[model samples]
Target: MPLSSPVPRALRHTRAIEVEAFARDDGLWDLDARITDVKVRDVTLASGVRTGGTYLHNLHLRITINRELTIVDAEAASDAVPYPGYCDTIAPAYKKLIGLSLMKGFRLGVKERLSGVLGCTHLSELAQILPTAAIQAYANDVIQTRDGAGHDPLPDKPFQIDKCHALRAEGPAVAVYYPRWVAKAVPG
Candidate 1:
């Protein structure tokens, strides 16, 4: 199971931290209040661990962060669950949201959307989609990169937010593997 943070429960300050952090980058914001709930999915091929084309096994990272990070009103965001059939079906359609060259743009768009809402002082809370901007931006970038770059592999630069609300921005922080092929054999 993924582990929740040591930050205890949500409070005004904690919520603020959560809001500010998530309000910047959707991926770093684990709105679910518990990191443990965040799962990274992988794609595998031919029963091999290291060989084959891979998709980020965890397609639900965006969804989970969106669902969990909406702390302004837990009740309102409670219903934001992963699509029932998403995992089973996403593989065929899965594509990287951010490629190597455009990661800065991809992340910047996320921050723009998140921060954009904060300008609304009258609104004490931010919406789920506000954080989703990152995901959407990445998706858009991925489509363009794939089409324009001719199948060049892009590096995944995953990031995370901490209790202090500081962002740990660095190289591909999270590694998710997707197997291009799978075996019918079930483990006994």
Candidate 2:
């Protein structure tokens, strides 16, 4: 974890609607920002990765501003990240196992969509839309779902963003998350 810094007490509060307003008023409805510090967490059952019958992977992408973007450092909260269910352990060697091409595609697509939707011409414009909640919601659909039947995993639904944060500084930080599925069956 980085140094424990505190987030600003308050700034302009903007919900999805207000964010939309900012984007529209600023003519920045097609901007996507880069996602950094991306970490992948795997949720396994007691049966283990190959025998568990189901595995869930959550990709959390964290980024800090490198340009004229505002960043509000919020006190890191333990409960902020929610898990639908308990996870046995975070997998190791996931990157080597998942491959780079797929990772690049996923990250690139996310950045493109974000930049396109926000239309952030400058880093500041992108900063306003930082601290974006609902990123998890958006990821729900990006993750692949595996059924342990040797069939390919596919997206089950549309992605939605669950959380958003905004910081006004020369550079701002943001995080986006998505889920992926892995599964296998053990012979009883």
Candidate 3:
């Protein structure tokens, strides 16, 4: 359902985030995330004055992970920033993400390694989307979500079964779409 119309309001600032996932030929996956911030009105910053429609911040973050969802390579770039030299210098710090697992404690690990002055706020925020993005990219290709009829030998439950409201183990949606897993999900 779409949201109800709201009171008329003027546009001021806009922030756009885009994430793309790619399956590499070497049997790995790459998730690239970018963030852009633009102001509809002129803004003054310590670096200089940013004209309307110009980018105040443009950042990119990419992480390459193996089938196990463990990050093997990570990189970040700051193309446009409010504070040029200082803000761009922190891009290299994102390499700390290597070796972290997207399915396990990834958010907390990001905070511990890149919070506060350790990393740029925009780029760090972009990293948070990678986990879910990777999961969506690997839905059927890498991880068998069992969305279709199959008697595959994988024994573990579907990764998304209890992850959200609609896919809750005991929810009606599950009863109709994933009936086989329903019995195993209910309390004994």
Candidate 4:
């Protein structure tokens, strides 16, 4: 369903975040993400004046992970920014993500290593989405998360069974699509 029409409003600013996943020939996966912020009207900043339709901030981040979802390499770049020298210098700090697993406490690990002064606010925020983006990218292609099958020793439930409202083990969607994981009624 689409959102209903609302009172007329003028455009002010736009922020776009894009994430793309690619499978490397070497059996790894690359998740590339970019964030761009644009203002509809000219804005003055501490640095200088940014003209209308120009990018206020444009940043890029990429992480390479193996089938296990462990990041083997990470990098970030700031093509356009409010503070050029300062903002772009923080790109190297993202390397600390190399050893982290996207599926295991990735957000917390990112916070511990790159929060506040240690990292760029925008890049850090962009890193937060990689985990789910990777999952969505690898859904059935690199990893089989759907039917609860294909593993040497299958888990009691699929990884996505209770992760969302539509997939809740006790929900109707689960009863129809993932019947094997439907929650059993408790004996009263």
For all candidates, the clash counts are: 20, 41, 0, 0
Weakest ten-residue segment in model 3 by summed lDDT: 146-155
Tell me, what's the RMSD of every candidate? 22.0, 23.7, 2.0, 2.6
Q: Local distance difference test, per candidate?
A: 0.27, 0.26, 0.90, 0.90
TM-score, structure 4 vs. true: 0.93
lDDT at 68, model 4: 97
Write the residue-wise lDDT of candidate 4 on 58-174 in tens digits: 999999999999999999999999987888899999999999999889999999999999999999999999999999999879766765334343355667788888898889888
Candidate 2 C-alpha error for residue 134, in Å? 13
TM-score of each: 0.18, 0.15, 0.93, 0.93
List residue ranges in candidate 3 displaced over 4 A: 147-154, 184-188
Candidates ranked by TM-score, best first? 4, 3, 1, 2
